[model samples]
Target: MCSLEKRGDVFILTITGDSDHRLNPELLDSITAAVAQVKSESTPSTALITTAQGKFFSNGYDQAWALSDPARPKIISKKLRLLVEDLISLPMPTIAAVNGHASAAGFILALSHDYLLMRRDRGYLYMSELDIGYPIPRWFVQLVRSKIGSPKIWRSVVMAAAKITAEMGVEWGIVDSAHNGIEATVEAAVKLGADLVGRKWGGEVYAANRRVVFADVLAVLGSDETVGDSGDADVASVMNHKL
Candidate 1:
């Protein structure tokens, strides 16, 4: 489901597939395991760059699988929250090379990174919950608010379900830079990662600073609040109303 490669101090994680990589338990577990591997092998100067192959970075949850089991939605939600928390507290700098569309949970995943680089030729950053008829998770809202600087852009993303292209993302300060294609975007991310690694900052110190910076987001992710209490209903509503 994913592969991790190391080039000097930079670790590149690729979600391997030609399809819309869905956030199902199996795939999520694979990603989390890959991250754990990165964490275990990390050095003080190590950096990470996450990207994916094909037309989608991720299309959010596996709706069919989620609908098949009554308890699956909460399972995925909790797993996603845990993954975000891990990313936030990772011991090295991280970047997302957005090679394709990132929607809903995928959007949150990308934003969890410390920096973002996107492909300009195609794909977009989209928040699909509004159009899909699901309530945005409270932790998701908090994360987006913390990362996205402009209220207008955040509203457009969450409320309008806007498909934000690379240029717009850079202009709005959500993306660090825009490259011409998937390869170029990943290359840029690697270059940026190398630059960060050259700083040779202490990994624990960097992680501690990130935790302080995103304390609110961490708090929300750590909470025991259920989806309904967070203004989100069951994933069945999405399955029934849309897919």
Candidate 2:
């Protein structure tokens, strides 16, 4: 379901759909382990690119996983969320090449990366958390605030049940850069990583700077938008109607 390619020290982790790039538990575990190994094994001036093999980067968790084992949803969701948190906190640089629709938990996963580059012209990215009866988690909103600001835009994305479009993403600044397609996005991200790498502090300086920027947002997530919330009004709420 996923393949790890190493060029020099750069690790390109491409997630292929199960059959059609579908999600699988074992595949996810392998991807997570590859990331962990890269973090531990690679040296400075290294980079990681999280992208896809087929049209999409991911379709969130496998529908079959939930349907087949209804009782395991909570455990599975929690584990995936925590893994994403780890990905966000990784010491090395990370990039998200959003090749296609990134919905549900996939949005959360993309948000965890340091850089998000997308194929804007392809209508490639959408956040469908609200449509899935999933509550808006604090981390998700914090990511938006980290990129945009604290305003109606954030609430519209969070509380109002809205799907942020690619053009809107460019305006909001959540995506570091947008291009005509995935190839363009990757080229730009590679250049971005090249400019970022070999710098003093190994990109930790920028990561630290984000703490100052996200002070309030982080505090909000600590309370009302915890990863374990699953679904609740204050932190998360379910909805089916369109915004």
Candidate 3:
């Protein structure tokens, strides 16, 4: 479900296959393991970039799988939340090279990165929970607030479920830039990562700065206290009827 490769000081993580990369136990575990590998193999000066193959960067949770078992969705959601926290706290600079459509939790995953670069020829960044009738979890809301500076864009994405195109994403600060294709997007991200290497900051120092900037998000995610209703039950209900 995931692969990790290193070239010089850059680590490239890719979600294999053309399928909608869903956040299920198997895939989540694969990603977690890959992350662990990256941490072990990387140095303080190393950088990481995450991207995917096919038409979707990710479509978010595996709704069909969630519907298959009573407790599956909750487990997946918990793991996904942890994954986001891990990404946030990863020491080196990180970038999301979004090559295709990213929806729902997939969108959140992309936002977890420090920088985002998207393919302009196709795909969109969509926060699909509102349109799907899923209540936005408190931690998610906090993340949106911390990552997206424009309230207008945030409302458009979170409240209106806006399908933000690459150009619009750049305009709204949702992405650092837009490229003509996946190759270009990934290339740009690598270049940006290489440039950041000049800072020579240690991994812990990089992560510490990011944590402070996103303190609220980290607090809510790491507290082990329920910030609010996670909407896991609601998600299961929707999956049961719709998937």
Clashing pairs in 2: 17-21, 17-22, 18-21, 18-22, 135-237
Those runs of model 2 whose alpha carbons end farther than 4 Å from true positions after fitting are: 18-24, 142-144, 203-243
lDDT of 1 at 155: 96
Q: Provide backbone clash counts, one per model.
A: 0, 5, 0
Query: What's the best-to-worst order under lDDT?
Result: 1, 3, 2
| Candidate 3 local lDDT, 1-243, one digit each (tens) | 998888779899999998989878999899888887888887879899999999989888888888877667667778888888888888899999999999888888899999999999989998887777776677878989998888888889899999999999999988899999999999999899888887898999998899899989988774322222456555457655321
Q: What is the C-alpha lDDT of each candidate?
A: 0.88, 0.63, 0.84
Task: Kindly indicate the candidate among 1 and 3 with the higher lDDT.
Answer: 1
Model 1 TM-score relative to the real fold? 0.95
lDDT per residue (tens digit) for residues 109-228 in model 1: 999999999999989998887897776778889999998888888899899999999999999999999999999999999999999999999999999999999999988886434343
Model 2 weakest 10-residue run by lDDT: 234-243
TM-score (all chains, Cα) for each model: 0.95, 0.77, 0.93
Candidate 1, clashing residue pairs? none
lDDT of 3 at 11: 90
lDDT winner among the candidates?
1
Per-residue error for 2 in candidate 3, Å, reads 1.1
Worst 10 residues of 3 by lDDT: 222-231
The positional error of residue 43 in candidate 3, measured at the CA in angstroms, is 1.0
